[model samples]
Target: SFHHYETPEDIRSKTMEWIEDFHADTERNATLWTMEKLSKHDGSDPENYPAHVCVMEFVVQVGADTRTFPSWKGHCVTRRNLVHFRGLSIDKNDIRWNEDGFRPLPDLACCLEKEKEYLLQNLETLLHRGGRIVARLKEHLEDQDQSRYTLP
Candidate 1:
């Protein structure tokens, strides 16, 4: 039983809903760890500075029993808690694809290029602001004068 839509808007909305549901399902099975939340000394404590990050592993699986791909051998931090780092390879494969068979080269390339452009455009601000943020954290730690405050 098929009900054809009369308008593109109806079709678009239905498609969007379907895609949203699909993503929801995928996220249910995926593991997500936030470093800022995970790295805190106490469960209630907040992170004073950004963590030196790295990707421990990445693997693509289908359902519980099927292993679609092996875990990515190399370690690289593709993203931070908020900001994304570029040129990190998640796997040996050149590209990853979705269930709909859409290869992510174009999208990844676009995202990487946009990220690079953003970094280039804001390099001075990023460096200076980042330095200032670090300096402020250092000053706070120094004012406290606690050996425990220092990051290992």
Candidate 2:
């Protein structure tokens, strides 16, 4: 249902653009606006339903332990069926549509979390601040062969 609104390539392009914009600006984080239809996929009156557009904000920051992390956090404020707008924090990872008595959409929350991870991977390449030590360690490990075969 969600793919009907935004394709995977669309998501990737938008995410990459955001990262690039943030890197160039260096003053403000990148903001992305995406809309996903909160439907049960019953295929009834899909066009008549209005989806609550979500606004997500992201920033790349280094932790105290010197690990790079993407601080991608935002809330989904959705107006249900032309009514008043209601919201749930994406940071919570458990979205409960209590206003309309709709059950929690774990998939939606999971998708949002996955976007954050994707942004982190993008940041690793853009910022190159994930940690030199870790990168070196990974390189060292990869350089060594782990084959269990014994040569004659």
Candidate 3:
């Protein structure tokens, strides 16, 4: 599934192998993917609603169970060898709320890889938007500074 930028075939294949190995590990199932990272916020919108979809990953988890329901630990990476971003927190309690844990490695690997593909495809667009946001934020701060009275 080639997309906007061409990754060398060796890199792609090697990356998948590493992902599969990590997934199959009994002690660690580390995956990297992009999602509409969100956090519960008590903002003007709502007291306990997920915040907006920024390009940044909030270490948020999203999954579904094949038996009863599923759960996940989340991490995001945008490229072949680099971790995209790391957040301040994770679901620290190991929330497997389905009465039993049921995560098949192959399926989980596919799910993670798919999300990674989606992120890779849109990476350019997202980066442009982020740049625009930064420019706008700088302007906003400057405006606020001008409005404040300076002590002589």
Error at 138, model 2, angstroms = 33
lDDT of 2 by residue, 105-140 (tens): 112232344454443443343234331111111111
Error of 1 at 80 (Å): 32
Q: What TM-score goes with each of the models? A: 0.19, 0.21, 0.24
RMSD of each: 19.5, 19.4, 19.4
Candidate 3 on 1-152: residue-level lDDT in tens?
A: 34435555765675455435545664443322223222221122433432222222212222111111112111122221112212222243221212222111112122355454555333323232221111111111222323332111
Ordering by lDDT: 2, 3, 1
| The candidate that achieves the highest TM-score relative to the unseen native structure | 3
Steric collisions counted per model: 0, 0, 2
Could you tell me the lDDT of residue 100 within candidate 1?
A: 29
Candidates sorted on TM-score, descending: 3, 2, 1
Global lDDT scores for all candidate models = 0.26, 0.29, 0.27
Any runs in candidate 3 off by more than 4 Å, and if so which?
A: 1-3, 30-152
Q: Any runs in candidate 2 off by more than 4 Å, and if so which?
A: 1-3, 6-15, 30-54, 58-152
TM-score, cand. 1 vs. native = 0.19
Best-performing candidate as measured by lDDT: 2
